[model samples]
Target: MKFLRKASGLLIAGLILSACGQQQAENQTPAAANGDTVGLAISTQNNPFFVTLKDGAQAEADKLGLKLVVVDANDDSGKQAAGVDDLLQQNIKVLLINPTDSEAVAASVKRANEAGVPVISIDRSVQGAEVVSHVASDNVAGGKMAAEFIVSKLPSGGEMVELEGIPGSSAARERGEGFHQVMDAQQNIKIVAKQPADFDRTKGLTVMENILQSHPNVKAVFAHNDEMALGAVKALEAAQKNDVIVVGFDATDDAQAAVKAGKMAATIAQKPAEIGQIGVDTAQKVIAGETVESSIPVELELIQQ
Candidate 1:
């Protein structure tokens, strides 16, 4: 009887091992043996546009089987500075940064360079940094597209309002520069009201509400982002002044809905997903000690009618 019990115990152990092997085979995932790691420091994950970019980066990281760390700055430059410094402390192989303030992040960029961590600035650029690469949309071109739409929709020469984004952000500066370039060429279209909304819908709503009251005849408005554009629309609706044309940037889902409903006249779309993907791809190359270009410009699209 004792001999029979020992044989039965051995049989049970063998069965368990067999099951374990089968489970391991069935539940296999991508192996992360590349010994590569990357970190993404995004300004704010609150914005849908930035969320899309994060998703793209995550997807590419999984595909590449690289360890990826992500952190949100919540639109705070100080927080962003801390997060990047922390990532560096972890000795991450590469860094992908979507800066909060183009200028404020320059020091962090320099720090990453000092640590021998190659940085690929995604969407926004940091000044005076040894960045390995920059992946972003041509903000100037996108702004120009938005401006063209605004001019076309209000061609009879009317006054307009402008809502800008973060003060030191490349997107804000470049897009504003592009819009101003076009605005400079137009004689009849006057920018009577303008303010910085900080790319927030709530701020946009409040600022636009005040602007509308003062510039009641404002024929149109150009918001740097769909969030602000949506806010401006709500302000217009609440004040019973929905007739004014609104052109938004980023082509967010809300803005697209507004466009379809004829509430928004047009929007300039950027490929946030593509920017994230390219940023990750570049990060991987840098991790492998590979050389990459200094800038990777993304395409933009104009949406109307």
Candidate 2:
């Protein structure tokens, strides 16, 4: 009888341990199973434009009750590839990339493709990868607008300089192409010196300073993005070339303020926040297995003083 009582107590303890183990297992559900999660890989958050883009995406994701994981590459393509790999390992339902360099980002995008994680490009397109949708402004048209403004300001066809963005970037290539399409046709207009500043303000200042040494009489300047434009403005200010018409893209707050202060001639507003919001919305549709546009264009406008 005592032996039977010992067995009963042992059986109860074993049953209790089994129940606790099952409860612990249930509590340790995967993060993805807790909620729908998506990943956003940005080229760089150091820039105000990309910061706003990230903010926009986060806001929308929060409203939809989704987990939005973000990673910043700091403008390094290799880091972006590694970041994408990390996101893929996290069981992300979708991946959004704002590539630092379009070509270099392809390997990362292809890896996402192989993992069956759909990719949606934001603000910039990726090369050699399949994407469910591309969310961005019409950069080519924005470039054309900048060129037209420069032409209007320099109706007599004067020498000007261009500060290009990062080399091998779709934004740089397309914007430069659009600018040339308009400026090259104007026989009176001349691009005296064009150089890449990698879309950085400090580099823009340095490059503009160097260009001034050779083309001091340049009547106008167009920078691919606002940071470079602001940099060029600083360089021109130091040289006291205040009358030079300087135009820029990505009408960031600083650039807009500069325009209002009469420091910059104009800027093309690409509505980065809208781009980010649309990107998340598109991701939702893609997740729902719904058909969406292959390319989604956000609005663009010219901001002038």
Candidate 3:
């Protein structure tokens, strides 16, 4: 009778141990039954644009009870690939990539697709990959808008310098291209100077300072991003060239304030908050195995304040 009792206790203890192990495994991930944990890796968090994207994706992950892993690539293509590899090893169910380079990041994206993790690209499109969705502003359209604003402000045409972002970036190329397409139609306006600032504030300032020396009659300046715009504005102010009209993209907080204060002429407002919100919403849909569309173009407003 005692031997029977001992056997019963051992069997019960074994059952209890097994149950505890199962619970631990479940706690380690966002999986529920057959559902899997989700992950989101982006190119860089150095820019506020990317920071907003991360926030939006995280909010959605919380609502759906899915694990969202965010890794910053630091604008390095190599680091971004490693981030994807790490996420895959973690058994991530979905991948949202904001690639450092459109074409260069294709190999890693292909690997993620092979791993069966659906990839949703945000901000910039990935070249040479089958992305589930691509979310970003229509940069070419935004560029055209900037040109129209310039024409309206300077009807008689004015000599201006262009502050471009990273030369090869799609945002920089398309926006700059659109600017010239409209300008090409107008024989009055002229591009006196152009230089690459690499989407950085300090570089923008230095480049503008140098351009001002060669083109002292500069009447207008267009920066591809707000950070660069802010930098160019400072240079203009220091040179006491307040009469030089300045326009910027990205509608960053400082740029908006500058517009309201009349220091800035206008800004192309990219709805970062909306972009972020949609990134999260789409990520959830992807995890649910529902198809989503690419070229998610958010609205852009010309803030003339």
Candidate 4:
């Protein structure tokens, strides 16, 4: 009878221990859950520059054993907002975005902010919302370098066309500012035609063709990005105006190839991959409760044949 009583007490203790163990397991965070997922909202994948940027982010995420969810906005502000909304629904640990439109992205950023998800802006910026960090090249400096290159090629100072990026975008505004700063200093250098191509290759081609029709004597062209620059090169070739000096930003693969073949005079090489990697790293740091700087500038260089 005493042996039976002891066994009953032991059984009760064992059951309690098992219940405690199960409760502890339930309280612990899941190994493959929220902390393991990262959301990346890219402006567009059509551009090689952004494609490389996304690849860099993905590589870094893989190295860190994190799952990255990527969404392309296709350069549409509305689509970008919707994409961020979708990512928010997935309970992403962090949000890294290359905004299609700086101002329009603020709403998405605000939503992430409300959700308590840290945001790291990559390559582009958000206007109104608080961001944990921004990772990109010094675009203004790159623009200045491009302008100087064009000026150096045309020592006598001549008419040039400026193929701007998407209107209201930070890249477009800052690059235009930097280019104008140098060009304005040179009284002899004149920008005959300045128009926005929305940083698209097709629009760049059409815009360049139209500008060529109006300003055939334009001596040089400065495009805000490689895609636009390549399109401008196409138009120049078609018009047999190959002699015009062309300077472009973003040393993408195609741009480098063009430079090697002497189709493009030069390209300011912004490290898009580095920018992307740093953005992901920053997101991780923020997720780990670390404070990062508001802005992180990647290195830039000039590439020529």
Candidate whose lDDT is highest: 2
Clashes of each: 0, 0, 0, 0
lDDT of each: 0.88, 0.92, 0.81, 0.89
The full ranking of all candidates by lDDT, starting with the best, is: 2, 4, 1, 3
1-305 per-residue lDDT for model 3 (tens digits)? 99999999999999999999988776643333354576667767777766777787777666556667888888787898898899889988777787777787789889999988888787777888898888888888888998888888888887988899875566788889888888779888899988998777888899999999899888888889887888899899999998778888988788889989888898898877677668767777766667788768888899986
| Comparison by lDDT, 2 against 4, better one | 2
What overall lDDT, based on C-alpha atoms, would model 1 receive against the true structure?
0.88
Model 3 scores a C-alpha lDDT of 0.81
Residue 87, model 4: lDDT of 95
Candidate 1 lDDT at 280 equals: 88
Q: Write the per-residue lDDT of candidate 2 for residues 1-305, one digit (tens) a residue.
A: 99999999999999999999888767642432356789999999889999999999998887666699999999998899899999999999999999999999999989899999999999989888889899999899999999998998888888999999999899999999999989999988899998999999999999999999988899999999999999999999999999999999999999999999999999999999889899988887777788999999998899997
The TM-score that candidate 1 achieves is 0.89
- TM-scores for every candidate against the unseen true structure: 0.89, 0.89, 0.85, 0.88
